[model samples]
Target: MTKIKICGIKTLNDALAAIDAGTDYLGFNFYSKGVRFIEKEVCAEITSVLKREHPKIKLVGVFVNSSVDEVKNILDTCSLDLAQLHGDETPEIFAQLVPHAFKAFRGVPTDITGYEHKDGPAFLVDAAVKGMYGGSGVTADWSAAAELAKKYPLLLAGGLTPENVADAVRQSQPLGRGRCLRS
Candidate 1:
């Protein structure tokens, strides 16, 4: 079965809702400039409750152009299980967070060249919206993602909705789907 991850979780209510909906992972956006950005204290409070109530659910911290120290600090402070590097983070930075971190690409890459992690979701593919890191509401390149999926364990994000999810799955064949539920 394909795993489901609900990104941009800002409140305990949203987190619980995603868990109730059978989501496998919950993403907390830490990019301060992003619309869905959540404070570290708020995320910590939410994650703490989740760890006790829903240990099976994995927690991921989403960062964009943040320093390795910042990511590490947040991960430890927030009790996050993994990190999702969604900006132009270097391979060196990725290496430092190996096994605990995965990269999120704006679009389909020609190859997984420097992002060869042996654990977790591996990589996430999001829409390549100009000047935007994610949650662009634009559909990802499913055709291109299909080709990339053949090589990597991909998590497809970007314009996914209940209506088009089946088709997205059929076309991209990703290991899972990541979505930011907005209300």
Candidate 2:
């Protein structure tokens, strides 16, 4: 079965709702500039409760260009399970969080030389909207992503919705789908 990640959760209610809906993963934005950015304290509150109530759900912290130490601090305090490096973090920076971190590449990455993240289960794939990191509602190239999926698991993102998600899943064959900002 394909796992689902409901990202950009800001409140306890939303978190619980997604959890109840059987989403395997949940993402909390830590990027201050992102629309879904949640305050550290607020995120802490939400995760603390979730940690006690639903320990099975994997919690991912979304970060962009933040220092590895900063990300570690938050993940430690919040007890998050994984770090989704949604920035230009070097392989060195990513290695610091090794065994618990995964890099995110915008659009169809042509060069994955230094990444070599075969250790981790999957990688996040999203549209490379210029000037926008993610949550752009711009669909990515599924054909390219499907090809990548042949190598490893993919966390398919970018412009996913209830209506088209099935098609996206069928085409990309991702290990999971990360979705947000649907209306």
Q: Provide the TM-score for each candidate, comma-separated.
A: 0.97, 0.95
lDDT of 2 by residue, 1-183 (tens): 688998999999999999888799899999999989989899899999999999999999999999988999999988899899888888889878877888788997887765656654458899899898899998988879999888877799998988989999999898888887442
Alpha-carbon shift of residue 105 in model 1 (angstroms): 0.5
> What would the TM-score be for candidate 2 when compared with the true structure?
0.95
- lDDT, residue 111, candidate 2: 71
Q: Stretches of candidate 1 above 4 Å error?
A: none
**What lDDT is reached at residue 143 by model 1?**
88
Estimate the Cα RMSD of every predicted model relative to the unseen true structure. Answer: 0.9, 1.4
Q: How much lDDT does each candidate structure score?
A: 0.93, 0.86
As a whole number from 0 to 100, the lDDT of residue 86 in candidate 1 is 97
Q: Which pairs of residues collide in model 1?
A: none
Best by TM-score: 1
